[model samples]
Target: MSIDSQKGAGLPAQGTPPVVPPSAPHSAVEKQVARSYNSAVANETLEDYSLRYAPKSFRRWSEYTVATTALGGIAYLADFAIGASIAISHGFENALASVLVAALVIFLTGIPISYYSARYNIDMDLLTRAAGFGYLGSTLTSIVYASFTFIFFALEGSIMAQAFHLGFGLPLWIGYAVASLIVIPIVIFGMTAMAKLQVWTQPVWLTLMFAPFVFVAIKDPHSYAAFTHWSGGTDVKGGSTFSAVGFGAGMGVALSLIAQIGEQVDYLRFMPDKTAANAKKWWTAVLAAGPGWVVLGAFKQIGGAFLAFLIVASAGTVVADEPIEQFRHGLGVYITAGTLGVAVFFVVLSQIKINVVNAYSGSLSWSNFFSRLLHYHPGRVVWIFFNIGIALTLMEANVFSFLNTVLGFYSNVAIAWIGAIVADLVINKPLGLSPSIVEFKRAHLYNFNPVGFVSMLIGSAVSIVAFEWGFGHGTFGTYAQAFSPFIALALAFVLSPVFAVLTKGKYYIAREDTLPEPLTVDGQLSGVSMECGVCTDHFERPDMAYCPFHSSAICSLCCSLDKACHDMCKKGGASSGPVDLTLTRASS
Candidate 1:
């Protein structure tokens, strides 16, 4: 046998997995689970990188490439529709105020979250595991993030369907499937395919995206007057003037995209290793791609409002908010031949670009979610089909018509989730209530951490109750509905710090990060290559974990699926222990 063959053939992958004694025999079930993990990784390429940290080698894309690709995901026309919906319901003053406030909040929260995810080379799900959620705790976040994707996917797909219906004379049902199915092939290759598509189509998309608005702005001044004065005839509801209540409600709808930062980080993680020489380029790309998405989204929404107003007389309130209809009318001023056809082309192009991202991010989210719950492994490709299927169903059910209602409810929970994360990163860790470094490995974390999980649960529940049931009678109930998300955000921010102080950061870290030298060629460990002792498979270090049951390093998927060994490695199994300052924090 070769020297490499003998390297880890019989010996354990070595840091003596803290689990059962080294001499304990491996169970048949343990062996089976390990084999399954190896298979899962082998089949999951389109995910770009999943289940663990993206390695340096895989970080081959330039900063510009990753940033632009992430930005491309924001090219969806839903923002336009959302903007139009709010303006028509709330009037110009409230809608404008809503967009600015929501954009500011989303941007602020995005800064730290984006920087850390990119610096650590982890996606939001993995980052959540360390930030505060802990092992099984992040499962809730995974589901919430997944819901955002499919909901947005369905909304975007609906827009595409409408375009097809108007242009090609296709049925909405077939258009829904067509819009949903076309994205599958693009996303199956993960970031690799997504980057190419976004970059190639960007110039054309930008020209088409901005051209209609510029033309309308240049040629039609009366449209602006109508937008400022119109309120979709909601005068009795106080829609003609600025209402604090209306602004808050509209803001809730816009902030629902706070979860979109997760999709951005998914691509930013692939940004090439930051070097001193490229420092300027690195930070620029990270900032632009990360939370910077809403900057573009906010303006596009304003444009959507303007265009919707331009067509409200002809299209009416029911159809005015549709991007297909808005753009068709906007383009009518400029084009004489195939006017509807040209408008449909731009709308279809926009939806395809954005839905691919929705589909891709949803797959990543579901992969993280089910892997933690089932302990059984299926590749991410399976989840892509699963994610798209859910969105397609929503499209068939006509989810787009109830846009504001769906998004308003969803934003409250999403705000809570994002708020807790931000609090942990900005406040808790800085105040010395928690560990500064993020410890994501399962063996090194508790199953739940109240700093984020408990806070999130309470915040989401309170906001939901307020959003649905009246907080008080008459005027107060209106305030409660509009300000629902602020309640979630404020409570999460306060509760996270409170929980950290109460718990004394005891649940933050389990055991220290101790990697086996045998699995790494160098003294230090990395995500490059490490051999799993049970399957004796060469796997990435990010996928490998120190397991005492087998007295070796096992891949995460195997460790999750293993039915035995029972987490004995961390001194107290299942139950968490306080952090030991003596153990020393790991440096990134």
Candidate 2:
């Protein structure tokens, strides 16, 4: 055929649909290979991106706009309660010093994590998996991260319950249940609606939070002077003598917020793609919404400490750590008739803002957890209710009464998890011990990797032992008592490189999966859609892998959930019998 005739024949006829070959990257073979699996096809919504990547197309919001919405969640007044409680238990100097140290560590660690998540568009779970912890190894962090969410959820819920009791004479039990359940609908829509909720309430929450502080400062400057010298008299250390032991204990509680970086990056993952044109805007948003949470958090903690002292000065009592009581008494000094009303409104608003973020993040954590452990996929929405149920139970168990002990204990594990991750990213990757880029697909990773998993395990065990003083009665016990978090972080950081060297970084990549046929279009964004054969749904290019078991392309979620494949797509993976997913759900 002549060249002109070939060109005319190659093009689709006028007004006729173009023919897409089944062998092409975006073939029309999506729903043809395997049986329909579960409700994953039905669950797609504004839940942003759960158990999947946030593609370029889904990232429609500007960097600054998303940052503003994400930053607003930090207005949770639990910082007020936690700051007051620690300052009362351990002196002002110890608590303040501890807060500064913890904030510094959290900010430094958050930077690499935030950059990777925004640049690659993955959540903490996927980041952990690709960093050094293997596919199943990262599930341990998933459970730990999930626990952080619910623990904070329960703590924030208790604050809201107290607000309810003070405002409406509601019973504490009923208030706890109400506070726990009210966030379900708000978070069900995920970032889209949740972002709006936080943005709209930011103005009201900021006004109310600062109003009492400004009012108190202007009305009675003497209270500030009184606040400086008020030492919470304790049986240990004899009233704020700046003991090393006190600083360590206080720091243990403060460092629990380190894991909160996970929740922040969940939103940052949806940030619009950074380009040469918007590079400055992107970095500003990442820092402000990422590590900047703690900058504001540290300030609020100091504010809370001062507020507690003001309550002590005015009310002649040092027991004002409870948020409802602190706000009630602080506002009472200036407002005449409706002080309780104003205090209750601010407290409730603050709790709602933080709890929504907590609940939403918890749901994501739970989804990662169950999806891995059970090998049966349920929608993220189902896990939202499960997470709330656990938090509600924790609230009823009275987590607030023992907040210091709980957070101090949790801080050890939280920091250890973060330390291992940070060490892997900063130390191992650049040293040529591990892969340079993140490979998160299940087909590309081992079931578990010892580099991160073993490091976190040993770190947690050593820290917990020190927390309980497993060291014999000697200089070691004294050191352990004052350096628990420091000990855990140092151990994890040091051990990660050692483990990486020992393992030779062999477990980082399972298979290269060099496909015979391309899984992506030649010239398009990674968001170009490819259909999953099993689920009968389209997913972004990165999320779709060519499945040898099904002999077609399938989404990564379906691949991860496929027990029948038994990782047969990878080397030495033999095919197994298919799992009855419905029966698995029923038995559970």
Candidate 3:
């Protein structure tokens, strides 16, 4: 959390210890080292493509490129739809205020979370593992994180389906299939392919997005004032009354977006290695494009609210209620002619841009879940279909009709998971209650850690209760619902430190002493390159390592998938000794 603490720690000096060769005696210690090495270093396309290790070689892209790619995912038109829905239901003033509050909280928590993931070359799953969730503890959170991706994928796909219905008169079933299928090919190659797709599409997406607003303002200056004065659809006067409990509950629903930082961190982990030459750009890009996503999101929400008001004023009561209808009306007001065609074109373009990100992130999440749970990774490409299949089922079931109920219930769990992660990254590490470096390998982590698990459990339980009960139903109820996100945030932040202290930081790192020292020249760490055992290709020093299990120096990607070792080296066992010695000892 503090740069001052990280700086000035010179690399291990020369002769401090010779590089431990992979040929070390086949003792329990050597076996443990081998398991750790193998677990952390395995398949580049599959492991690094999802949730395992992040090697220096993969972090070759510049910070701007990385950040831009990550932020590009936020171009989804859903923000506008969500903002407009909230405005119509809750009133414009209330929606605007709530959105601002949510953005601020997301930004503050995102700073530490984003920075750590990029700096450590770890994704959210791995970061959670080292931050006190332990190995298995974080697995539960991975399921939660994975659910966030798929749920949003369905939502984004549903929006695109609407566009298909409008533009081509396609049945919803066909539209869902089309929307889901198009993204699979784009995501099959992972970040390499996604980066190019995002870069190429972003400029046009942005231009189309704001062009209507510019036209609206230029043609009728009075419309802006009319929008500001709009009272809204709800009968309850002047927005819901301010109450701690009500505010908390409403904010909790909005704050479910905290999990989005996980997706952003996915790209950020690809940021170029932070050397002295690139530190400034790295920090700036990461901070701006990482957590800074909330800023643009907040604006979109407010813009949606404004557009919704305009639609209601111009089109009629019925049209204002439907998001597609609202957008159609807004386009009509701006376009001179071909209003229907322009509206359909804008909707399809926006939906495609956002849906690709949704499908892409979901595939990564599904990949992480199946690989760890089933121990069989078909490939990142396979998971894309798996994720889309889930979304297609949701569409068939007509999930959109219950969007409010679904999102509200989902927010509780989503906030809890994100809250625990942010707390560990921001509070535990700074207080020295957790390890400075992230330890993600199965061999170097306990199956469960209480710090993150307990925090998430507590936060979720309280928020769900507050949401279900009308504790803030009266004058105070509105405020409670609106501020629930802060409640979850506070609870997780406080609990993480408390739990870490209670546990005495024992679970933070499973095997500290066993980790190999950094490759160094003189007193400073100098970059060295080595070949990956699996791919038979060269990688940077941080990516290449010696593994004693297969008795070869393997890459991080190969280590993730080499289940043959059976984690024998991680813990002292019969397999830790040489084959001949173990057989002779057993017979004796």
After superposition, the stretches of candidate 3 with alpha carbons farther than 4 Å from their true spots are 1-48, 234-249, 313-323, 470-483, 513-588
TM-score of 3: 0.83
lDDT of 3 by residue, 1-588 (tens): 332233212112122222232334543433453322233124454335565456554666778788888988887766776666666666655666677888888898889889878876668887887777876687788778777777777777777788778767999888888877877666666777778877887897787677667878877768677665455663323333433433343455567777888888888888776768888998998898789999888887788777777766555544454446656766666676877676667666666666666666676676666666666566666667777788788877777666656677777777777778877777777677776656676644566888998898898777766566636567555554545555566787788889988887766544322223243333222245554444455554444334446544555445555666555444431112112222111110
Separately for all candidates shown, the number of backbone clashes (residues 3 or more apart, or on different chains) is: 4, 0, 42
The candidate maximizing TM-score is: 1
TM-score of structure candidate 1: 0.90
Off by over 4 Å in 1: 1-23, 27-40, 233-239, 516-528, 539-543, 571-588
lDDT of 1 by residue, 1-588 (tens): 221222222111223333435443454445455453344357546546677678765777888999999999999999999999998888788888999999999999999999878876889998898777888999999999999999999999999999999999999999999999988888888888888999999999999888887777778866666667666433322335788988998999999989999999988878776667888999999999998999999998888888877777667789989999988888877777888988998998899899989988898889888877886557778888999999999999999989999999999999999999999999987786777666677776778988899999999889988898848679888788789899999999899989988887777776654563322233222545666666565656555567666656666666665555556766653222222212211222
TM-score of each: 0.90, 0.88, 0.83
Off by over 4 Å in 2: 1-41, 233-240, 313-319, 513-525, 572-588
lDDT of 2 by residue, 389-460 (tens): 999999999998898889988888989999999998899877867766666788667888888999999998
Candidate No. with top lDDT:
1
Question: Candidate 1 vs candidate 3: which has greater TM-score?
Answer: 1
The local lDDT score (0 to 100) that residue 226 gets in candidate 3 is 62
Query: Candidate 2: TM-score?
Result: 0.88
User: lDDT order of candidates, best first?
Assistant: 1, 2, 3
